[model samples]
Target: MFYFFFESRGNQTDPVVIWLTGGPGCGSELALFYENGPFHITSNLSLSLNDFGWDKVSNIIFVDQPTGTGFSYSSDDRDIRSDEEGVSNDLYSFLQAFFKEHPQFVKNDFFITGESYAGHYIPALASRIHQANQKNEGIHINMKGFAIGNGLTNPAIQYKAYPDYALNAKLIQQADYDMLQQKVSFCEQATKPCGNQSNAKDSCDKAYNVCGEIFNDILAIAGDINYYDIRKQCEGLMCYDFSNVETFLNQDPVKKALGVGDIEYVSCSTTVYQAMSADWMRNLADGIPSLLDLGIKVLVYAGEYDLICNWLGNWRWVDELVWSGQKQYAAAKNGSFMVDGKDFGLQKGFGPLSFLKVYNAGHLVPMDQPKPSLEMISRWTKGLPL
Candidate 1:
């Protein structure tokens, strides 16, 4: 694993926060360079630093995980297909090596944060850390908490949050909402009868496909184009056309300043995906429950506009959690919120120890709504009232 560290100006002994990138395959640089970090693309597509980067308040480390993301790669030709356990083990090992190298940080409070598929990654890693803490006496791992943005935590809830989010976004008409609701209800009621016999996997795939079709139809009517093209257009709004791809591909100066190497594949690389898939499945089945039982704080956030891991799905998943004090902190309305203090209206809430549904955001919440995203994260890490 390769890490990108942002030192705190306050003190070297200050708490250290580790940021994980989603995808089971994604690298942290994508978040560092493209999202809520110090760098943003100008309207002319030039790189500019965001003044509100989290680095201003605390030391942050972004990790390229599972040994195949970013600059990290594996020489073994073994199929990197992993579940949840593999992820936890690898991360546990990485943490050991990481702290050993930066021994000063061994006692600093640490937080694990991420988005998207990290809904799974963060919990699994937390579980491993907790287990290690128990196994080793007097050698404590000061794991404070974890946070996720627009996460994919529970499969069932995630699949179900579709029509509600669509209706709120005004992407689907009232009639379409009624019809889809009926279909969804029927699917839920007759889950067994509709069986292709692949268990929940087949059912979820079917449900998601139906959900995707509904959203696709809505986008088709609104944009007069295919959903893929609309997504491409949206991404184009933020992407910079670097004049010298080679120079930009070199290790980012910001990352270098933070003490990381120039790594290949900053974003969507095949190798990253292979390692992620392997790690996610392994940990989910065995690793995650261990951490939750240890009382490690886990916060999962979702962006309402993100069709990839829609708020509907996240809401559904969260609802399935058996936590006693879980409550809905924010309500879903139009693709925006009315906040009393903040200029950028944020739909804020606190319940069951997780934050969900930032408004006006797509799959990439930080890219679409950086200010609120950062604020949510800051408040969460500090254990402040949201």
Candidate 2:
């Protein structure tokens, strides 16, 4: 039972945007209803309508995928196992089932988008879809492009983006930046030995530790950042609260949005974790390469302010892309551009792909900068000359 949001505008057959939530264990429902949906919360904690939902121009489907997310679950006693291949396969099955249930959408244009660890999910799913298309089997998914915000695609690239993003946000002092850079250099040198190891390198571990230390030092100097406080600023917007998991799970609004019944868990369920761990192990090697080879367009976006999946780490991973003939796109300095009638910013970029950095945004760009995020996505999906 997957939770989804559907919209049909007049006679236009808009693309079906399947939005996947991040966290090899996270729920896409949370991203939709809470993080950046068309609904906001009232001062009394009641729900209100959001005017900027993606439904305005497309049929959006927010799924709690891979089973055990939100309303989606599996009764097969098989131990929950998740990997790039397994997830890709599971998603394919789900799409098959979904199309059967909603046959009218069989030929609708489809696009996949997600955040965080979905960096892995989106690419793998895209690859699977591309493969199925090759065999002329399953529903004809009019897949055009993919998108992610503040994603965890390439661990290496994500790690390196930290200091630069910090500097841009004015969150780090010059002295601190220099210190962090030296530490990064040392971590890079140390990671050389573990380059070929299946397990992540100790150097990479050290690099992450050093980066964490830099963040810690910044907090020490400027006071710790309050994520909840940031959420309060967007008071009416839907947000996640893991405090009382049971109550949160049973909440009517959440239940309705996620299309889940009672007796289900929210946030971290055993099913979700198993699926995530399985996927991690399977894709440890050759996952990204396998996807790129299929001619599927894999795009990753990052919010500069995000610390969890920092731009530095993501960048580190992307730099490892070995696929030939791949191109890169760069964003303008001011980071501002126009799409439709809306003005959005450049965010960021690597080579042919550009990562839009949402100013003042955190790990959840939609929550922090919903309008800009939406605009950026609109342009991306259209493949417009941004």
Candidate 3:
């Protein structure tokens, strides 16, 4: 539960947005240094200000959670979390303590935001916060809304988009798509019992394995292409490398600056990933309708180029969401998401929910299209148009 907070450079009263990176096990420092943090790690192993960092418009917190990721750790194995309940509770506790300690920013508008697997994390955590607030939770957080970027929220709906996305992107042939559709059909069947109805670990784990093969099948056809950004090729096993973040964080002077005495920086922990495996196929989107019903704004945005958690999947899930605003949202005309008077993406929304499809970017929207991503968030948190 180690977190880094960066004050807003624009306004002290601006919203506080906490960022969570997704590996199901990745640390948020990856977002801090590489994506939307105040600074970027220079080639000389030093930090340089990032002009497009989100902190320019709002206070930002990048946290490492679930006990085994990043500098956060526990001696007890019981501390390791396997599902959203434990994960959400831990984050709720952290926020309570954080707001209590930093009372200066307590009244400022708060937002939950992250990329990738954070799709799963954000909705669950939001539901937890809303429930706790309803029960007269301590230190009422002025939560305004949350935004997810390239996240995997509804596995059943999202998984079904895999074959169609691959075929539309021309990454696979018609025959390959035909085969993948069968995999999707099997995945849907396997995932049914794991939906909002049950939390059976064995059933969920089986669904996770079965649905995962869809991606493996796509990879088998599309070789060496980065699933994060289909436009690029992986250097090795990773589409993009953050070894430099690891190197810089491990530096003696850097660790001392951060007061992380001798704690090794883990960019991603496989143990945490394995622990959360059975929770993967569970439909996190099931929690969203309630949040939206309470007027908790949700913005689901995705980088169109990503294959792993592609915009197609995100769009489908958001569109298929059964909120009160569902009909209006479906009927809403697609609008241009403009940055500097030019269209950077497409967006659609009604009341408390919105979806944006960012162009010319990948899984990490902020990293691929920095200025526009910053513009998107600045407008979003301020209740301005996207």
Best by TM-score: 3
Q: For every model shown, what is its TM-score relative to the native structure?
A: 0.74, 0.74, 0.98
lDDT of each: 0.60, 0.60, 0.91
Which whole-number lDDT from 0 to 100 does residue 255 have in model 3? Answer: 90
lDDT of 2 by residue, 127-238 (tens): 7887788799977777776776666554444445566666665767788778778756654554444342334534444544544554465446545554222223222212
Off by over 4 Å in 3: none
TM-score of 1: 0.74
By TM-score, the better pick of 2 and 3 is: 3
lDDT measured at residue 383 in model 2 versus the true structure, 0 to 100: 62
Better of 1 and 3 by lDDT: 3
Using lDDT as the measure, name the better of candidate 1 and candidate 2.
2
